[model samples]
Target: MQTVANFTPNSIVGEIEKVLDTYPYNPYQQAFSIPDIRQQLIEYVLVRIPCADSSCSVESSQENTNQVPVSKIPRTPLQHQLHLQNLIHQGICVIMQMKSELISQILCETVQPVCEPSHWFG
Candidate 1:
């Protein structure tokens, strides 16, 4: 979700390469089969929602790692909005990183057809 204003094309392309490089280089392993990154975003939302809800009996001292029910806590409108914004920001970061990496790979692959043959000709 990074805006065009925030990211130059070159930097976005670099990010794309970095993400692709994270995977093993096996031809059989499709890079598009990227593991479920959404789960991390879900976990972030889960943690923030419960923490924001003021009605939860669990003291703030309790660690966020515990799984708590949303129904167990009453969340104020403002609290919910704040947590929602936080979650949105986190989701955007994850998505933008993924997108940048995919675009980089596509650009590199596409350009290969044009740049590679000329080397042999010369």
Candidate 2:
């Protein structure tokens, strides 16, 4: 049984990287290829995880701040790993969903109207 101290942010990131590596690069349209997008996905998962330090807070301007207090629960290493895995999967799903919607919107905007059969024949 690993202690809470053992579950550092680096370990969490390593797990995320491992999962990301398992996914193929083609289907995402090179989304994972973009460093910023990949980092965003990692950050998404990291923000959701409870920080080990009670005083830990993200640095953001007052106008844009949306802070939420997270309650930490003690768990075994396996449970911690599982929780992170679940969060990683969810983050991937959200990214993919957004990508799909963006593609759909672009297609809708770019698609030309079809000509009638008579016009084609004429």
Candidate 3:
């Protein structure tokens, strides 16, 4: 997630627009569906949890992921599922917020209301 402190409002809004524009304009042909995004989020979140010793590497994490059910290994199936769901929800919420902010900016800057007839005829 990006913080507002990282960039000026104008730059951030432009960047977001550029990213959104890269996607397929047709909803039916979209590259990433909600389930696909959710699965990606789960994988990302799983690999990101810090190890007990605080020196976990990608290789080590993969090893842990593949390990058998040993007594020392962390094992909580339901908890893990709930955590993944939470992460997915958070990811979607952040994207929605960015889009909302971009829409608000566009409406504020580009959209105008007609207030008088004098300008309309010209």
Candidate 4:
């Protein structure tokens, strides 16, 4: 039985990195090149996903309690992989949205106010 503890966040990171590798030449790839940014996205996704067992839910797990046996429905390896891939896609969407908002805020802050032209008669 694969316990929730066995599913490390690094596994999710590895899977995400594999998908990112396919877009090596993408213009936005540089954002993920920073390890911290990539890690943040992984953390975001992990926090949103429920643990396989309620006892080890993301909320309680953060408290750093010792691992305890949890009863839950078992999923085949293929099913688990597909579920993870779906999550990776969702995480990528979130990163893109955050990047867009950041860029918009920077542009708003740096934009200069345009002066109105004086009338020729004036």
RMSD of each: 13.9, 9.8, 13.9, 9.5
| Candidate topping lDDT | 2
Give each model's whole-structure lDDT.
0.44, 0.63, 0.39, 0.59
What TM-score do all the candidates reach, one by one? 0.31, 0.56, 0.29, 0.55
* Colliding pairs, model 4: none
Predicted candidate 3 versus true structure: per-residue lDDT over 1-122, tens digit per residue: 11111222333233333443554643311322335443443344444333322322233233466532233333354543344445444544554454455445544554466666786577
Question: What is the C-alpha lDDT profile of model 4 across 56-81, one tens digit per residue?
Answer: 42222334454332333124557667
Instruction: Give the clash total for candidate 4.
Output: 0
Candidate 2 has its poorest 10 consecutive residues by lDDT at 52-61
Q: Name the best candidate (by TM-score).
A: 2
Q: Is candidate 1 or candidate 4 better by TM-score?
A: 4
Which stretches of candidate 2 lie above 4 Å from their native place? 1-6, 52-74, 101-122
lDDT score of model 1? 0.44
lDDT tens digits, residue span 1-122, model 2? 22232446677678877887787755453565557667877777777776633334433333434543223433556776788788888988887787676645554555656665766566
- Of the pair 2 and 4, which is ahead by TM-score? 2
**Reference-based TM-score, model 3:** 0.29
